[model samples]
Target: MVYTICYALIFLAEILISLFYFENKFERKASKKFLIISLPTAYTILYFARLFNITVVNMLAFFVCNFFLLRLCYKAKIKSAIFHCSILLVFNVTTEFVVMLFSAAILGTELLACLDNSVNLIFQSTISKLLYFSSMYILSKVSSNERRKESPATSLMLFLLPISSTLIIYAILYSLAEYELGQVFLTLLLIGIVVLLFSNIAVFWVYEFTLKTQSRNMELEYEKQKLKSAAEYYDLLNEQNENSKIVMHDIKRHLNAIKSIAKDKAVTEYIDDFIEDFSINKSVDYCNNPMANSIVNRYKSFCDKFGVKMNIDIRSADFSFMSEPDITALLDNLLENAVEAAQNTENGFIDFSAFVRKNKYLSIQLTNSVKNIVAVKNNRIASSKKSDAIHGTGLKSIKRVVKKYDGEINMKFNEDDMTFTSNIVFEIRR
Candidate 1:
């Protein structure tokens, strides 16, 4: 009865560890009631399975219960669930094996004999659970924000520490499981094992720190590239607008002269038609600011070519406080992202509105259709781009510009309606 009680307590502790590790690391899909009922039920089943003393049955129970909870209760993919469950199982088994060896060596008894007494079993269980809990806690804290996969070689290198430690312990057990080592030797061996366990945890902490530093550096590089592109685009648009104005003035003078001297009625009618078409195709004035209008008109033409319905209601707003590069970066990225997402959807549409609110704040809102549900983390949507280096490039650029002007930006994705909306407000500076 004592052994059974101990097993139940150990299983319960493991359940808590699993819950902690998952709640912060993965997305959950079920309600609180479902989690409450399912966890206790899994705990009860796991407790009974351990009673059989069959390693295979115990392992199977552990894996299946955790796997189903991760796959059904949490939103883990099949492969991901399998991989996580296997890692937890390996950690549990390896920890228990190491603790048993430690307990047997210190107690001057055979490995199996260490479990014959409830006191010894309790001691081993408690030590094993503590080591398991500490390692997992560190791992969860370090890896909670990880979104990218490590290279195969990097993964292997990370796992090498624990794998090497486990192998060393396994060899020790196989060679001397039944032998009686002296107190001094056993004490030194126990210290070595403890250090080895901690070394594994330390590697994760160092790697996580290094990864975050690298990610920040990459984001800075991407921002530099975006600013450079925005400046180049602004210059190109400004020059094109100037050239178009000059060309239009010269062409109108020549055409009017030709119209007055033309002899044939057919030729006069063709000239009139050509002038009307050219005038109709002239650039649109989207707002009072020419820089803003240039970027907006550019995207409007893209929408026309791609058959995307675009609605614009940018009432006369002042942008004199904003730099030309800032205007280009803000509008160019916003429209480019919206167009790219909406173009892939059937009957895609983008509705954009910008106006001065109460004469002190400039309000801009954009809503566009999306083909798939976008993933949101910390109230920001993840990028749909394929490259990790350029992920969130547009949003980040917009955020930098907004911050420069003391503006506020809010983004929302309506999964049910398959639309994404961005709302930004900037206070007008005198």
Candidate 2:
């Protein structure tokens, strides 16, 4: 009775931990693995501890086992494991304390025979540990592991929790009974043991199914974000290309005016006016290719309109080998996101510098001031509020182009300084 009550209490505590702390702390799926592998392991460790002492000894072993397991789970990243496991420890200690109090209360009144008391202890420990943690595991299945369901008591999950857990309780006990024989059993016994073990962990099947669904969702979201960002890139590139063509068309008009007005005074005035106007707008930047120049100038206009300053130092952007559409598509998205982030800040700015480093590479470095902490998901930036579906596309599209030509792209955000820097290596074919 004491063990069953303790297990129930611990189960409740773990559910609370999952809700308040572990839900959104790290990558959702990775957190789920830690929770799944830890519970059975922790219970098994305490089971072994009962061989020595129930309260202090078993708990000590439980703690040591939990620490080592968490270390392995996080690859020894203590900071991350602490973020997930601390809450669990709090729940464990609390439940153990309550079980101790309950034991004192019950045993305070009666002294039992040795055989009966021993059997009682075994039953209490086994059933209490089994039912609670099994329920905790089930709760984690739909709780800690879900993508964005942060609340603990969503009616959908709360309704199913007990039914699933009760089913698992009977299943795990029966399964462990069949495997009560030692590992030496082979042939029929071994096969029977394997089947039992599989059924006992029915929750694992649910977890796997959920993970498969999650991966499919992520892939679909990636595709959607990719397609959305591709449009932005294409549009940015197209506008730049069109701007260059229109500027060329105006060159003829400039030439005719210069030809017609050969009066020295009027020619000087005309030339001076043209140079002044060109300097003020400065839309035609020659240090880079016309396509790239047009995109940068347009992005600059966006920055200026949003009260942001931009610094540009780009050169040798030879996109001749790249299909006009491809080059435009790639550069447009990269620069637009940078521009957007920068524009969101007070005193925000974007800095861009590009050059050809070696044989066939266009190297670009872009830095921007950001408004909030940016999240990194599988090397892409996304927010918890924003699903991977829309937010992951821009980064993916850039990487797709980089992969096509055998190049590299890297991004990092500095939270303390609110700065985001990205580097892209673009390859041009010979």
Candidate 3:
């Protein structure tokens, strides 16, 4: 009963650690009660097979069981699930080996003999479990704090660390298990384990820091590009506005000339239709702010090129609180994404609106037609484009602008209507 209880508790702790690491990734399709009762119990039974002391059985029970439970509880890609399981198994097994090695070196015994001593078994087990839990908790917290989209090569490189670590640790353990240890050799082994642990941790820290720094630099460059593009667009709009003014100034004279030259009925009707189209589809001045208007019109031209209908209702909205560059970045990224998504549909349309609500909030909504279901991973809208890093940066850029204003942005996809919606509400500062 004591052994059974100990094994059950170990399995429970391991399962809980797995859940904590994947809290964001999990989509709980099973009932809580069912998972609560079944996961640990199933793990304990499967792990009891380790008592047979077969290497294959141990590997299956440790790594395969973890992968299976995670898959059963969470919806994830196969590669992701396997990578997660490998990390957990590597940490757990390596920590245990390190603790056992230390215990044997101190007690002057063979590796297996350390486990036979009840006092040593308790001491090593407690210390190893503590080390595993602390390491996993800290790792999960650090990883959860930032969302980085790793390239395929980067992910594969990261995966290699744990795989190599696991194989190295196992090989070392097998080498030392059957031999009696000397004081000098034992000291070398202890140093090796410490180096292994610290090196792996340092690599993780450097990789995360580098990725974050790169992402920040990219976003800054993107902001600069937004400002530059906004200036160019506004300049173009100014030129067009000037030409339109010149055309409208002589409109009466031009109309009289057209009417007089058209002698045939078909030519007269064709000229009339051309005149009506110019009158109805003239450049739309979306808002009073020149920068904001340029951003909207720029996307409107793209929408026209791609056969997407662009709707705007922001004439009454006030955006004086935001800087020119901020306005450009925020609207440019949002509308660009909306137009790109809408362009692929048969009858694509984007509805964009912003208005003042309660005299203190500016509410904005952008809804666009989508041809395919939007996928969400790790609580983020997964990019459908081949270049996920680029797509992710676009989202991060929008989020950065929203954060600067201390606002809220929510995105949702309506499957029934086949549309994606982005809703943002910003507190009015002026």
Q: Which candidate is the best by TM-score?
A: 1
Each prediction's whole-model lDDT (CA): 0.76, 0.57, 0.70
How well is each residue in 1-430 modelled by candidate 1, as lDDT tens digits? 5445555666777776677667757867889899998899888888888889899999999998888777768877899889888878888888889889876786568898856755445546656765675567557756766565557688657666665665666565544555777867755555555455446555655775577678878878877887787778767886788788888788878988998999988888998888877753367787888888888888898899899999998965768789887888888888988998888889989998998888899998889988887776554665455321122777888998999999999877787988888889999998
For candidate 3, lDDT tens digit of each residue in 1-430?
Answer: 4444444444455655566566534555567886776676656756687678686677667777777777776666789889988988889888889877876775467887855643335335545655675568557745664566767687557656645664565455556656767867755554454445445545655675687689788778877786687667777776777687678657746876877887888877876776766652256678777677777877888998999998889987878899876787788888888887788788999999999899999899989988888865443686455321124656777788889999998877787988888888899887
The Cα RMSD of model 2 versus the native structure comes to 8.8
| Reference-based lDDT, residue 232, model 3 | 74
Model 3 segments beyond 4 Å from truth?
Answer: 1-83, 90-196, 243-281, 376-379, 383-391
Number of colliding residue pairs in model 1: 0
Ranking by lDDT: 1, 3, 2
Better of 2 and 3 by lDDT: 3
Worst 10 residues of 2 by lDDT: 109-118
Task: Supply the TM-score for candidate 1.
Answer: 0.64
TM-score each candidate: 0.64, 0.58, 0.57
Please give the lDDT score at residue 179 for candidate 1.
Answer: 79
User: Which candidate's lDDT is highest?
Assistant: 1
lDDT of 2 at 120: 30
